[model samples]
Target: MKWAIAMVDGILNVLKPSGMTSHDVIGYLRRVLQTKKIGHSGTLDPDAAGVLPVFIGAATRLLEYSGEETKSYRVELRFGVKTDTADDSGNVIETSVVFRPEQEKLVAVLKKFTGPMMQIPPMYSAVRHEGKKLYQLARAGITIERESRPITIYKLDLVYQADDYLVLDIECSKGTFIRTLCEDIAESLGMCGTVSFLLRTRSGKFVLNDAKTLEEISKAPFDHILPIEGAVEHFPELMLTDKQALRISQGVVTSISGVAEGKYRLKTASGLFIGIGSANNGMVKADKVINPFTQM
Candidate 1:
């Protein structure tokens, strides 16, 4: 039986579908789970689809620590057009003037993007300026000056190339604009383009293959909320005695000197996930103690 309450709170791996905004999933989960403490790791465009990690209850707080986690994507580019939206959902503003490249040239182009580079965020993005979304101004047919940010592209492989469409798998940092990437790739081949399709294959270490979609969630609500410790598995693990756990749970910081300095998991003798905490000067401390959830 599904419990009305969680035993512990962390993150939920959601396979977001096209046509629904990140806010839509959060809103739905908030009501379904009946909790105000909910948040998501990243936003997938309304036209794009794939992995969106939703943090629930105490897990929402984990974002502060997991902000630097990298992501991966699979994108399809149609190399004969351009759009204001930088995606296929926008108006076709321009057509190609250059001939399509051979498969070998496309592979070489993909290789160029597999490292650090600069990317300008799309106008149809949630980036805010003067207290308004950039997309708001874009919808009004207005253009604004946006700066290009540095991003790391760990991997870029050409999955396939169709008649006019190119498919690729890329591992990049957060905040990377895939639209800009496809456009740049097109430019490298002496053409104009936009993203025809995009699906996030991975986020940090979470893969879409391991995710549960909103449609599945709606049909069969799940109470399998992972513990907060699960979210910070990438961090170092630290064991604390029951006495130390109690002290930390009551908002007390216990000092365990002669250890490495960094964030670590605070677990009890019985292996109960207390929460996440940082350590320095050999003294470990709890920054946020994930309270044990009650059974309903």
Candidate 2:
């Protein structure tokens, strides 16, 4: 038997389809599952697709601890055109002579963007200014100065190139905007550019290969709700005795030895996931405790 969405507590690796906004996915899940506690670790644009990690019920509280600070994408950039929103979905604001950079030039430009760099979030983004989202201001024809923020590009590989389009595989730290990267890269080669297609390949340990589509999940929702522990697999682990587990559950810090100082995935001696714990100065304290009986 399938459990109701209200009773389900875990993470879901959803293969988000293009044309649906991140909010749309959550709204659809809410209607299908008949619950409102669902939330996602990150949001994807309406026209971009790929892995979107969703947390249900108590799992929503574990989002910050998910350790999903890195994101990977496969994006296609089209040169000689610029859009108001920096993507094909927006109005074309400028069109210039078509100019495709040579492979050597493109490779060198990609290298220049690798490592640490500054990126200004697009006007169509959700970055906040003066208590309003940038996109909201953009919709009202209001433009504001945006400060460039530091971002890291771990890798930028040119996958494919044609007459006027090029595909790139990017692995970057959180908060990177592919549209801005496309524009910046093209500008370096003396051309205007915009993103034509984008697909998120990975988010933390969640990958596209393991993600379930909306239809697949709708058919067997419970089968797609993964365990909460899987979301925090990147953190170290600590085993607790029954007594220690009980104490930790009550928000009591327990004294321990031989544990390093840092956050960890707390588990019972019998291998049941408890929650997240912080270890320091020979004491282990619960940061977020999962209700053992409530987990799926």
Candidate 3:
């Protein structure tokens, strides 16, 4: 059977429901859009739900840059329990008496996590170890030593608290594990804990409120797709001349001035996106040129 070709190239902010792995979402999109060139910017746990940016066609090329963007989450931590995976989905490893710390004590503990710190990745994670996924080894009951990675917590605020449950709003850098953070917080308070619920509120510029569900995406029009330019709108723009545009398309480095020494979104005089490039010392090097023709 002949498969339908997808000529569209853009990004889709999807609201992934619980019980679906990040790869599962991709598989579902492949069937719905009839395209294989699809990828997500970041991975969300199969048990967690929220904003997952889906890139289609040429937008897949933007994944590397987009993954560097910060993420925000609303997480619920349940005290008096600890799981092997640091989340409710894992096997119970330990338990303790439910103790709700005072608000001042909770605030003090959260302050220590703010800013940069070292974090050891959980065993049941996608991180690769010895040429195999950590989760793969975790399933076999094999545990290996893991090096701690540096991560930053830009903001950590207590949103709500009850007898055994505490909700927190966290804005952190990429690669952060909310489950691990919750476990650490509990440990600091002399108790055991795990992430009970997680919801990604924002990833880079994409907000959860603007995310489309699988049902909505199944019936979405082409207009629902965001252009590749939208993915890198935060970068400075560099307008190119016809001759320069041609050189960029051919992977030729053209001299440029007036722009700062940094990455920029190369575009034509008419606002047509060319690609991304870097400008420094009156020279602009072609990074990735999308359009060849000067006119649209």
Candidate 4:
């Protein structure tokens, strides 16, 4: 499919696979889409699978890689044991004090995690310590004392439950680890547990339903990518005329008339997304520019 020149520049969202790192997904996209300018907004553990937002072309410029946004996951918890990694891949370290509880009891126990709390990042994680990876230390049979950071767990819903297992749909701020949450739940229940499965159900507005698998993406004839402008559709906009679109694309802050006192999503007369802009007193400036259109 032929695309407009502005649209040909990078920005894409790829659904990552379980065995691949975020960087791996970019590499695959680079080969499939034939562009070296690919990047991702977040990191997904190699064992975890689900929606991973990928950026292509100019969209790679937008990656901040900061854990500032809320993240969501659908995960499965295996009760009756805890692992060194707190997931199925690690060595068993502790066993449950009691076998799995009844369904109602499991739901009740999970409710406590639905608010703000301190989370001590796992030793087998990507977190750095003394210029080294935590996982490196963990693999070396070394454990160091670490500080717990505050994180918010907005929602933790029980999707399904077995006699000794629970499947959860979680919405939390960035940096939350499903395995850790499972471990915390087991501790709260006076038992031990680990995560057998984890999948990111969402990343910002990117959802699993809209995600494409590697196999699917690899075979697809054309790049089914959402334009860079499509990534930040949540932001507000201010519509501009042809002249204004040109000026904004050139990095010239143009006066957007008739806008007052708030942030808006910016778009051109031809419906090309310009960027997010804020206005006060009929004057507007970009809050963040995602895509600049070709106009003269």
Candidate 5:
């Protein structure tokens, strides 16, 4: 089998439009870039729009670490309505006469959701249950119990409020379902609610302002792609000599110093990112070493 060299090897901060699945973006880029070595750091619901970091070539390896980074969103919640999917895209399961709660009460309720909490994955989500996707089972009129998973809401602020709708700015850990959080907030306020709109403002270090729309990406230079090292800039860096870098590239364990026990971005003394390494007890071992000869 023959593989063509990729045109670029980095990340694209794409502003995914609503009504398009994350895979849809990947497919589009595949056609544009003419390569299949691409992946997204996170899944954004089709009904939501915002910053989506798409990794190309060697950058795809950084997804595991980047995907775990914190994400921020601006969400709109419509009270007095409940949906099976917990968003406007789902069928309305219940409705109530809309009533606006006091600002103080709303603030109090929002505060309670901050910090760590267990969130139930919605039936209309992509979460797998018993070897099947929850959404697939939902469309077939089947519902199954799902275990609640621990998630953290680093910050949940009521940005704006009206008679029946409210806007919230949320900063949360990975695996958090904003729809579920909205529903829980409404329940706590003695009403029902569903996500009316969701816009991710940030995913790790990538922000919406820096994201490129599909049209922009089409017209932009290929150099718009950021280096793979930028994706893992949050990690501590361990610069190695040429000999040490070569050894690490070969998946060999090497001694390292002056770094805490954790993951570090492995780079050559000249500052070329080689891959990732783990530093523990003064020893460093390759976690995922990039082929310096092949990587951009």
Candidate 6:
């Protein structure tokens, strides 16, 4: 039996395996679904694994509206060693004789990293310096000063600690690098460290339990496609009349009443999720619409 090749719309809670880049999953799905209009909400390093929400077809337009900006990870930091990449994957730049801190001290240090703090993006990250990616420069043996950005570690709990390594469950805002966080935490405890392992457990609504493996997706791909509206389920909704929906779909800012000034998930009277729109001063304008060409 051959699966129909068509324009596939919606999201995929892909459980990325280690050793595969997020782009690799998008590339694979493009072949499996036979379409080029695919994108991902976030990029996971090739050595990291776990939930990667993929957008397909018209859903690609809703990527920016996804509430999955905050992410959670199960990470491991191995002490006594420092790596150029801040992870075990990089060359060992420094090593030292070290001792693990007491659980109380460790917990207190973790607390310091919680809430909001400034973080310097790692040299191996995709952050751009000038016109080139930092990682690109790192590959060519160049390192430049990078401004620290504010990031919030909503939750940081120590799951376990051994003689030389510790496991942590971290929930943080976007742009928070676990590798850098690991190093910083170790530094506060008077030791050098590197992220030895990473497993993303959550990306906002997408969780590990709901994520589908590549094998599972290959067998029944459509079954794993999450509805595009799920991407913005956190947003408020506005029910529209047929005429109003038609007007909004045509890029017109339709008049609205009693709806506070904010973004909304727009639905027609028939309950079709058309797209996302913003409201202001008694008017709502469609910011993203389901492009008709993507309909299968």
TM-score of every candidate relative to the true structure = 0.87, 0.93, 0.95, 0.82, 0.95, 0.93
lDDT of 6 by residue, 168-233 (tens): 999999888899999999999999999989999999789999999999999997988988888888
Q: Which stretches in model 2 have alpha-carbon errors above 4 Å?
A: 1-5, 292-296
- Those runs of model 6 whose alpha carbons end farther than 4 Å from true positions after fitting are 1-6, 291-296
Q: What is the C-alpha lDDT of each candidate?
A: 0.80, 0.89, 0.88, 0.76, 0.88, 0.88
* Cα lDDT for residue 202, candidate 1: 81
Candidate 5 per-residue C-alpha lDDT over 21-84 given as tens digits, one digit per residue, 9 for 90 to 100:
9999998988777788999988999999999999999888888889778999999999999999
Q: Which 10 successive residues of model 2 have the least lDDT summed?
A: 287-296
- What digit string (tens of lDDT, one per residue) describes model 2 on residues 1-296? 34454888888899999999999999888877778898897788899999999999989889987645689999999999999999999999998787668878878999999999889898999899989999999999999999999899999999998889899999998889989998999888888899999999999989999999999989988898888888888898888888888888788889988898999998887788889999999899999988642322
Q: Who is ahead in TM-score, 1 or 5?
A: 5
Q: Which regions in candidate 1 have their CA more than 4 angstroms from the true location?
A: 1-8, 250-253, 292-296
Q: State the TM-score for model 3.
A: 0.95
- Runs of candidate 4 exceeding 4 Å displacement: 1-7, 10-12, 65-69, 102-105, 241-247, 253-264, 276-284, 287-290, 293-296
Residue 80 of model 4 has an lDDT of: 85
Q: lDDT of candidate 1 vs native?
A: 0.80
Per-residue lDDT of model 4, residues 1-296, tens digit only: 43333335644456777777777787776667766666787788887898888776677655653235678998988878888988888889878556767667767877878899999999989889999989999999999998998888999998887777788899998888778888989888778888888898888878788888778777872566776665655555567888877776677766766667876668887787776666778767665676767746
Query: Which candidate leads the pack in TM-score?
Result: 3
**Candidate 6 structure, TM-score to reference:** 0.93
**Which wins on TM-score, candidate 1 or candidate 2?**
2
Tell me which of candidates 3 and 6 scores higher on TM-score: 3
How many clashes show up in model 5? 0
Q: How accurate is candidate 3 locally (lDDT)?
A: 0.88
